[model samples]
Target: MQVLLDTLAPADAPRVADPRALTDEDLLALYAPPQQTWLRVNMVSTVDGSATGDSGLSGSINNPADGRVFATLRRLADVVVVGAGTAKAEGYSPTDTPIVLVSRKAQVPESLRGAPAGSVLMATCSLSDGIGEARELLGEEHVLTYGSHRVDLPALKAGLAERGWGHILCEGGPHLLRDLVFQGAADELTATTVPRLVAGSYPRITVGAPLDAHLTLRLLLEDEGTLLGRWFV
Candidate 1:
């Protein structure tokens, strides 16, 4: 992908023209793949600051254009990670990339249970909750465990790399994103800010303990009310 750069006045500036148009094919072509291991967090939110609906679904946070960008991001990922709560709430299915679920308590919903053939992976901290059914449904290689109070992120990344997965994408429900950011594991964040406003006390993109270090980002592209920013850790 190509690399494109732009400047936004400031985060507190008033809205001018829609920014989504700047994220055209030309800009997307300029995006460079990260060297070594990489991870990106993707999210969409309303102008009025809501990440989901009253029913807690992100599906209502985007339009067709946003959906297109979301699909493109997914297509570029080697693995997609989400919390089990998100998987259940969003009724997630395994996509072209391998689906990874992070559950400290092994509470993955039955509806979003099975993986597509050999493409699902579950990361848990314990084996007390037998994965017998999940193993049968997704095959043995699909289930994984860290079995520790704190996961070894570097080790997990190495393991994924050994399996030929270097670019990981995180589609979250806040908690998972928080963990990744808190652990200093996320490389970039791609957020789509929609034109409409949905006022509420709903979630924002990153929710967790404040970062000890500042996260610096460059504005990559803006179009039709959407802004894409890239950050380096």
Candidate 2:
């Protein structure tokens, strides 16, 4: 990818190599988390601020450039965190890395029902009716309950850290991203803006009560009109 700006690199240095010429290793080096225990969110949106295309899924909005970065982030993370809604909507399956599904409901999504043992986990609430089902599907040890009514994001992060899964990546579906930011549980955001205009009723990258958080842009890259930005929250 072409480096539009990199705060860590000297301005006098040469610009980035060609985007088309970059390999998977090059992308990994570019997106590697600077800290060991970091929480970063990866999201894609249209120029018109729609998080999804007509299909109403994030996959519909992403391009090949975003796909490279997406895979790189997943490969770099110790655990992949995603909301149950996104997991279901995107037809998520077990990845090489562990996946933690955050849900208000206690039942596991069908897409992840056959996931390998210990490869997937459910972060739900004790109040949810299907806690037993969740526990039965993913062993009791894998089902983490934090809050009474909802999955407490901070506590979930702490719990993951305790398990030595510190390099965290959250693949969001808006509401989960909003909760992470609102609860001060997110460390950074890596957003890819696709060069399209899908002006419909789709939500923004984050959806919830109005938030007023300032983020510092640490890196910016562009490839084929798609802009990838890394912002520290």
Candidate 3:
């Protein structure tokens, strides 16, 4: 893999200028063949460093600008993935991209049963749980079952490819991100850090364990209230 840092420099001299003027979308163009295999992990925190609220909601950390950026990223992905716990807590619905929920027990909320026909994929470890609402509502074929232990991510990717899914985007609730990072399944990481801190006992971004060797990231862009960093591992 290759790493690219897209930043504006002074025209007169070979010096760097302001870094907080470029957007993540502008920096993403540096990646060759945007349609190629790519995954984006997104997280939001408050000005005090808190990632979640008392009710365990990430929406508290997100603003209107963040929402727009998220939606745009979702549009670029072929499959949008999240943990089932996150789906239930966030009340997620199928968007433009197909939805994939990672659940060991295949426990899906009845409210999300109507997830935009043909755009839902439930990834579960157990086959005995049955599709339940996903079957009668979203069609039987939309549900996918994987290993009972750790998910065979490579196999899942191959399966998704067979079903015509190439680009995958992972929107996290921390634990899922940690698993992906630990498994070395994440090819690329796009993180937007807002200029705020929310200090609390709640959890922040999870990466399973501390890296033995630091994973280097290129500073892609930094806008007024956000900083976009990219890493290739």
Candidate 4:
């Protein structure tokens, strides 16, 4: 990865200024948040501002550099908060790191049926119907419920923090990202711009109801036509 713009130091001397290439370890360390209770969002979008490409997935549009950053971000996170739609669409499997699936209905998709117990969690509303299923498949401690009929984003964050999973990472499926922003739970965002034009009615990074979450640019990187950026929310 190449540093294009960074606000860490003056324009002349960037704090991450490197004469040699950065190793994967160094890169992951640099992406880590300042505090434990930080929430970071990771997303990829095409040049035309669409989140999906011809394959109806971001992977079709994202390049190798984006994949590398994606892996690094996952390593830095304590818990990966994802939506069931994305978990299934992306064919997510259990990893060494825990995965928190946020849903209103608490439905555990079939794709996650093979996941080892306690490796995956379900974050849902109190009135959700799949509590018993989730608790049986994933351990009881892994099934977290907050609001009565709607998933409380803030409460979910707090619950994760209480369990020492403070470094929250959200790999959204649009609507979940919108809810995170609307609930003011997101602390930072990493958006990689793949220089491909996929002009269609595909969703952007954020969807659902409107939100007013503010963000400030922190770092900018480039690899050929791809631009990787990080912003503080």
Best candidate (score: lDDT): 2
Clashes of 2: 0
Candidate 2 structure, TM-score to reference: 0.93
Ordered from best to worst lDDT, the candidate numbers read 2, 4, 1, 3
Query: The CA-based lDDT of model 3 is what?
Result: 0.64
Clashing residue pair totals per candidate (backbone < 3 A): 15, 0, 10, 0
Off by over 4 Å in 4: 9-20
Q: Better model by TM-score, 1 or 2?
A: 2
Tell me the lDDT of model 2 at 114.
75
Task: Give a tens-digit lDDT track for model 3, residues 74-168.
Answer: 66677888888888888886666788887766666665676677777777654536557545665778777667565666556667767777777
Candidate 4, residues 158-195, lDDT tens digits: the string is 98999999998999988988888888888888899998
Ten residues in sequence with the least summed lDDT for candidate 1: 1-10
Residues 1-233, candidate 2: write the lDDT tens digits. 67777785556763345544567776777777887789999999999999999999988899998998898998899999999989988899998899999998976889899789999999998898888988899998999998999789999998998899999999997999999999999999999999999887998999988999899998888888999999999
Give the whole-model CA lDDT for all candidates, comma-separated.
Answer: 0.67, 0.89, 0.64, 0.85
Q: Residue 97: error of model 3 in Å? A: 1.7
Candidate 2 residue pairs in clash (backbone atoms < 3 Å): none
TM-scores for all predictions: 0.80, 0.93, 0.77, 0.93
List model 1 lDDT by residue over 6-123, tens digit each.
4334456523344433344433443344465777788888887788867778997777656766767776778887888888888887666788777766555676565467677876
